[model samples]
Target: MNESKEFLKEYDDSKYKKPSATVDMIILTAVDVETKARSVPDKVLRVLLIKRKGDPLVVDITDPYKGKWALPGGFVNYYEDLDAAAIRELREETNISDVYMEQLYTWGKVYRDLRRRVISTSYMALVDSSKLNIKAGDDAEDACWFDVKITLLEEVKTQIKAGYIRKTTYELSLVNSENEIKDTVIVTKKLEGRTSKIDLEYVNNPSGLAFDHATIIFYALERLKNKVEYTDIAFSLMPEMFTLTELKKLYEVITGKVIYSRNFRDKMEKQKKMVIETDEWESGKPYKPARLFRFNPDWVEDQ
Candidate 1:
């Protein structure tokens, strides 16, 4: 009986030795802006990368994204709440504040970290980059904005196809039009990239960065797709004020598809969640004055 009791004690104690994984959020934002009277949509996806001076997963950024491109993350401190830790990591890596932040995903692949089994309690933040200045801090080599490129090329992903189906009889004009049916097919021939190819390169490739952050870039892209439709997350990346067209464009970048203005706005604005600060007009653009708005945190209060 004593042996069994001791065995149970060891098993219980073993759980304590296991390192607890932490949460790291991938912050995202959609910024709507006015350009030449036409609204332009841009994503508020910033690189929260710092330099890695030590051991971890080794990756090659190639002739692109080199030097300064990695994720904004850190070891979760004991006693720090996961949400608080994610926000702290964001602030520590990027010298910016007062933006929208939320949990994105938990990246816990055993090989995600080379030095240890770091199960990140990841979070995502959206900010108006045009409104604040960012810099490298802590382990970050540097920080900057890189345009995201989401590829929908035919060669890359499976094409969704639709067509009418019909059969012909042996006799002329005996085609089976009466039995016509439409068919849609997804050619799962080639494997889809683990994540869609969302590419981000340095606005200026001078600063040296670290890691497989492009993967994080892709992860952010995917997160935005689902987030914009449901949450007020898109506005986190937009300016304090914006126009409808610009809002639509922001939706496009997040969804990887073009959204019709009227229908898109009908759905987008109705979310009744995120709103903009209106009565604001053109900044420096020469066009019809468009209204602008900022993200409303109230829509997300207690949410």
Candidate 2:
């Protein structure tokens, strides 16, 4: 121990250059898009984005994506943990805290950041949209929630000796009606054997999302879609109390599929035991009042 301590003291810390670490947050929510006053609302997924403040980096004289939108993120402090840095950056950029976030992925592509070498670890969080009181941080010019829609443009599959390769292309659209911001991002996913990769370019980003955020958003959306099928993660985007219809709608929106109401209710209530019934019913609807239920966190254990 004494010899190791002496070696630690004599070790040179700056012998090699290291990449700066940062954290980006993909904050998502489910929103009810209103049409006519009496029409039933349409449910859609929404993602939070911030407009860059155009501040020059210490190593650069100008910002590459100044005044454009991006995921809420910043450099990680020297003494902070990765998770802590994600939470802090989320709060600072969007005035959002008290959210449950999961580590999505780490991006370490060279030249991803123009100014300096940066490695970003992304985190994804789902929240009830009604609870947000968003404000732009010092590094951001504005904060907004854009309705998200991802559409499959094309797909192809090829058989290989070892395994099959599937390639799918998707168009991700973000629209903020109130802000009049419409952004389009195109991404492609290539699945070779057991591995898959997402690719995007600056030219593919029509609305100027900073760095490789469109790819991160695409990855997070795919994760959400897969997890919502088997896990109870979708409940994070829902309110404390919701009707069976509302729950089904939220699931359909996230998965981009049409779910039969009867089958969905049966599976959620009987097989999964994901929700518990309450005596309370929905009010002020043109149709019959629906019973409200709350999520049962112990469903997995109970099963």
Candidate 3:
């Protein structure tokens, strides 16, 4: 140990340039957006975003994306762990903590950040927005949950020797009705095989999100959609006790599909055993109250 310490003392520290590291959080939730008509409300997927503050020092001819909306994040401290940085950034930006979060991907494209070479590690977080009190943190001008809608615009598949290569293009839209803010991002995904190399790119970014956040958001959404099919990760976006209808709506929002009630319940309860019956039922509805259920903690995906 003493010999190692002596070697470290003589080692050069600045032999190679190190890229700045940042942690971006893709915090998602489900909420009932207000509508014009008085009727049963359906929940939609929303993502928490921070409005970047215009810094006079940083804003110049080279940096024109100062005031645009971006994923909630900040530079990681040199001593902080990646996961710890993600949790800290989430808590600092949205006043949120203790939610389901997992590392998604690492983006290190050169020129992704114009100011400097920055490598960002992204984390996906799921929360039940109804239960949390959210507010913008200090580093941001404002924070809001924008309703998320992703539409597949085009797709192509080609046969290859090893496997098929599929390329899909999507339009990602985020709208905050109350704030009158809307951002649109176009991204394309390429998969070489069933489990081979995967690539993501931003085809068009009109609103100009900070860094390569639009691509990161697109990747996280894809991961969420795929995970919900086989995992109980959706429960992180649900309340402790919820109706099957509510759960169905959340699933529909995430997967962007219409799921039949009977099949959804049968698959979730009987087939997958992902939920357990609760002693409560939804109240004060015009129709018959539906039975409430809670997530089954011990449920594992069938291999």
Candidate 4:
């Protein structure tokens, strides 16, 4: 043990370079948008973004991407934990806290940052927007929730020797509260059977989300879609009491696909422990009132 301690003491700490660590937050919520009917609103999935006040790559005064929008995040402090850093950054940048968030993925690409090597551990969060008060702080010039829409543009598969390559392109659009298009990001992802792996790269991003955030947002959306089918994650974005139709709409909006009413109802019925019928009905609607239900707190432990 003494020899080991002596060797450790003599070892040089600067022999290897370390990459800076950061935490990027993907804060998602469902907001009610006014449709033709003012009583019944349409639920839309929205993501929170912050406009950078300065260039992240350098201290250059005239950087074009300085004012670009990106995820709320910052460099992790040396003495802070990763999860703690995520929560801290989210609160500091957007004044959002006490939401359900989990580590989604770690992104480390050599060219991801132009200034220095940075490895980001991203977290995904789900919250009911009506419950929180948000304000822009820290290095954020502005912050707002943008409605998210994703469209599949093209897909092609090519056969190669002993393998195949699949390429897919998608377009992501962010709409502001005034019902106008804020920005659009185009992404191309390639899946190669030779390496049994998938890779994503940006094709065109007019929104100018800093770094590889466009890909990160796309990844978080895919993760949410997959998890909603099996996990109770959808409940986080729901109100305390909601109708079955409202629940179905939430699922459809997140998945970006139409679900059969009969099928969805049957599935939810099977999970009897998940929701409980409440002696309540929705009000202020154009049509007849529908019975309301609430998520069962007892089943949360099992979920």
* Whole-model lDDT per candidate: 0.52, 0.83, 0.81, 0.81
**Most accurate candidate by lDDT:** 2
Candidate 2 residues lying further than 4 Å off, grouped into runs, are 35-39, 55-62, 159-161, 178-206
Q: Write the per-residue lDDT of candidate 4 for residues 161-237, one digit (tens) a residue.
A: 66777777777777785533333344333445536767777654544577788888988998999998877789999
| Ranking, TM-score, top scorer first | 4, 2, 3, 1
Off by over 4 Å in 4: 38-40, 55-64, 178-195, 204-207, 271-273, 298-303
TM-score of each: 0.60, 0.87, 0.86, 0.89
Residue 135 lDDT, candidate 2, scale 0-100: 95
lDDT agreement of model 1 with the native: 0.52
* lDDT per residue as tens, model 1, 125-148: 666556666776776665554444
Clashing residue pairs in candidate 4 are none
List where candidate 3 sits over 4 angstroms from the true fold. Answer: 33-40, 55-63, 157-166, 178-195, 204-206
Sort the predicted structures by lDDT, highest score first: 2, 4, 3, 1
